[model samples]
Target: MFIQFLKENRYVSMLLTLLRFYLGWQWLTAGWGKISSGKFDASGFMYGAVKNMSGEHPAVQPWWGNFLKEVALPYVDFFNVIVPWGEFLVGLGLILGIFTSFSILMGLTMNFAYMFSGTTSTNPLMVLLGMFILVAGINAGKIGLDRWTIPFLRRLLFKKTEKEQFPQSA
Candidate 1:
């Protein structure tokens, strides 16, 4: 019910777009700063994430801790490139609405990743906004590039081919 309303309503969608833009801007600036500074390495952060793991009310999950210890920590160089570029791309997608839903999904995934690493900060709020945007569906992107790109991509990917597959008698 509420989802339907959010999806179908123009004003609601506009509001959602604003939120989307905000998230996009956030990602863009963060990534751009990293790229420009040439010092946005994730190695130190990853090390700290592992070191921060504690008892009882631990911030980081043990499973994530294991992954960090086993995979991420050993591959700081790889993560350094991936993180900044990933943030930049996500921000571009969200801002342009070229792949709005997919962009939001990616953002949500990153939020989860950050949270799992024990860094809360704005992740919770971003996740909430991302969820709402996801719930709003195409409406969230009706005002942006997705409005055209999505339909075009859909037709390109799923066009009816029965007529082309078989000759119909006139």
Candidate 2:
């Protein structure tokens, strides 16, 4: 099946590596830009999203807008810190393939948040590419650090306990 091919195919993994690099670069640069600027703020953006809930066809739904106004706006300081750092970390993870699936999921989450806020930009395209990387799963990161980290983590987490390993005469 197509899903199997995406998950298991070496060629698909190779292609995914390329896409991962592209997405990673985009995120790193965007985050770096904000971080370096030292003036990144989400309050204005949140306010705009809330305002966008009006008009003939609202770009942002009232429910999301209300959440933004009530929850997000009140927590603008937190958003200001996390947005840039989260983007940077996601980008780094994607580029290094250290935690490819988690990185892609985080990136997708940010993309969806941006879209929900009515800032389309390249978020949709990034989401599409990210979904492919997600479907490809471990294979997508096989060529990178996940090659060793995943197996190591798996063994560490799943290793048998002392009782299980040394169960004897009872």
Candidate 3:
């Protein structure tokens, strides 16, 4: 029932758009800080993530921690480039409502990854908002560019040519 309301109502969509803006701002600032830095690095964060494995109630699963240390740490330099730009792009996508669900999904994925690394800052709140927006589906972006963009893309990419082949009857 609530989901239906969110899908159909304008007020709910407006509220979700506000949430999207807030979340987008958070992502944009975080990424912009890293990108603007002369030499942004993820080695420290990766090291800390690996270190989380030692605690009794480790934030990361042992297997996942091992993967991070063995696989991720080795490529910290690459992550250093990817993470910042990815965050900025995700923020831009969400703020513009271009593929909003995809943006929310990516944001939620990052939020979960942060939680798994034991950094419990605003990640949980962001996750909740991302989930809410995801559940809202197409309506979530109705107030943003998706208003026209989605429909246009759908018509172009998923256009039903067969349906249009039928001529009008007299």
Candidate 4:
């Protein structure tokens, strides 16, 4: 019942639109800040995360810390490029309601990654809100571009018109 309401309710959709805007702005600002700074470095952060695995009840888990040290540190340059741009793109997607599900998923991925690195900040809240948007599915983007894009894509990909899918009553 609750899930159906979330998925189909017009009022809930409006609330989701507001939530999307808020999250989009948060991501856009954070990404823009990093991009404009021209000195966003992940190596230091990686080192800190790796070091965090040492203490008892370490903030960062050993597996994640190892991944950070071994994979991420070696590819710090890649992270440097992808992190800011990924955030920016996710924000843009969410705001535009194009690829809304993908945007939320990417945002959640980043949020989890940050949390794993021991940086809580606003990540938890973002994750909670993001989950709501994700669960809402297509309804979350109904007021945005997905209203058209999804249907167009469905027609293009499935090669089925709505009339065929739902025959009109004579």
The candidate that wins on TM-score is 2
Question: In model 2, how large is the Cα lDDT of residue 143?
Answer: 80
Residue-level lDDT tens digits of model 4 in 1-170:
88889899999999999999999989988898899999999899989889998887999999999999889999999999999999998898889988898899999999999999989999999999999999999999998999999999997898967799899999
Q: Can you rank all candidates by lDDT, best first?
A: 2, 4, 3, 1
Best by lDDT: 2
- Name the TM-score of candidate 1: 0.92
Compared with the true structure, what per-residue lDDT tens digits does model 1 show for residues 90-121? 89988887788888898898899898887889
lDDT of 4: 0.93
* Tens digit per residue, CA lDDT, model 2, 5-29: 9899998888989999999999999
Cα error, residue 16 of model 4, in Å, equals 0.1
TM-scores of all candidate predictions against the true structure: 0.92, 0.96, 0.91, 0.92
Shift in Å, residue 20, candidate 4: 0.2
lDDT scores in order: 0.87, 0.94, 0.88, 0.93
Q: Report the Cα lDDT for residue 8, model 2.
A: 95
Which parts of model 2 are misplaced by more than 4 Å? none
User: What total of clashing residue pairs does each candidate reach?
Assistant: 0, 0, 0, 0
Q: What is the lDDT of residue 117 in candidate 1?
A: 84
